[model samples]
Target: MEVNPNEITNYATKFINILIDYSPKLISAILILFFGLYAIRLVNRVIRKIMLKRNLDPTLTKFLADFLLWALRVLLFVTFISKLGIETSSFVAILGAMGLAVGLSLQGSLSNFAGGMLIILFKPFKLGDTIEAQGVTGTVSEIQIFVTKILTANNQTVFVPNGALSNGNIMNYSMQGQRRADFSFAVSYDTDLKKAKEILLKILNDNPKVLKNPAPAVFVQSLTDSAVIFAVRPWANNTDFGEVSSETLENCKIAFDKEGIRIQPYLQELSKKNS
Candidate 1:
């Protein structure tokens, strides 16, 4: 069959007319898309400054900023698609379904993430803080969206789930900037109380790690069934707390031995019975 020239001409004219009808809308949508992306970046910058001013935790700040930017971009894309004469309600529904699926699949992780957000927002414990929680004592090294990394006392690294940490009691030892070094020493009942007190005080004063402002003290804490107990209380910087406590006890013992101050046997009666 011979093709009609008029039919081909009519088809070409119709296609051109369709293009002409859509050109302005397409161009405007494209312009808005580019402008929307630029505006998103600018908004992100402003958000960054605001987060800095608020001193929001860095991990949460970055997560929130990225989430906001991506969410805005998604909405912008849907707007652009709608402007191009495409239906977007289906797109919204699809996104919502996907989010729900993810939320359900990652229920535990989502809980942890929410807990982490609470930790960051409420400021219970921060990075580099020495905190004890969930039966582990460690310094918080990293705070993430789902977990917190801790460097334990024995130099071991622990990854604790934020869900547990946030929900549990956290003892933030470093927050107060100082800690008390508490120790007790027992001497034979026959030992001189004044000499024992002098020896304990000397140990605390000798160590520069022990703070003097709090005025270290050695007092007659109690009289045990077998011996006299003296309590040593000293203040020290939190960072030096362990060292100060250990050194004070060790040195006090040595000093007591040298001074002939008897550290009564813990089981003095048992020793006597055995003898």
Candidate 2:
């Protein structure tokens, strides 16, 4: 068989011409890739510094920075592909379709993650703070990207999804530094209202846990057929609220007993006996 040198030379020439024609674009793409990476890093750093200046939560700042970094890198890759004379619209469309599929599959998780981001950014409550949300009242034990851990009064740990928690109402008892302990004490209608109010007020004043600045209040809230309801409101530090209320209720019972003030239930029993 006769070897054709002309055909071999023609193939080499075509290969060289193709490489020469694409070299500039390949080099430009490489340069853009490096520059785009640097720019992404710079943007991430700037964003982190801004978040720090605003005193945003450290966890949230890191999460956002990382997310932005990846997003920018994806955009940079697409640009690099386009610069190299590659069609990118179809690639971008494919990526979008994949993203949408993943998003749909993890809709609840994405919602929770978004909620957690909002919680961390807005800081409605912090760790160790007592909060009432999603029908659970407890101290926040931990906060994560999708859930919050709460330590209930019974020592049970409740994991609440951040989606429902952030979207729902939150009562941050620890935010104000103090909370009002409300108590409803019913007394017999025959009992002296003035004396009962004095006793309740005295109880609040004597308790060291109670805050004096707000000044505890006692008023006749409502009158029933058998009793007068006294609404006692005492302000105390969040930490001492439970103790303050419990001790005050115990003290009230003792004081009322000593003062010969018959409570509503006792009068009810007496009425039943007489009838």
Which residue runs does candidate 1 get wrong by more than 4 Å?
1-20, 53-56, 265-275
TM-score of each candidate? 0.84, 0.74
Check candidate 1 and list the clashing pairs: none
- Tell me the whole-model lDDT of each prediction, alpha carbons only: 0.85, 0.87
Clashes of each: 0, 0
Each prediction's RMSD over C-alphas, in Å, is 5.9, 6.6
lDDT of 2 by residue, 60-115 (tens): 88888988999899889989999998899899889989999999999999999999
lDDT of 1 by residue, 1-275 (tens): 99999999999999999999999999999999999999999999999889989987787789899889999998899999998988888988998999999999999999898998889889898889998898888899999889999999789999999998899988888898987766667788889899788878887898899898888878987898988978788888988988887787779878988988888765111100111
What's the TM for model 2? 0.74
Alpha carbon deviation, residue 109, candidate 2 (Å) = 2.7
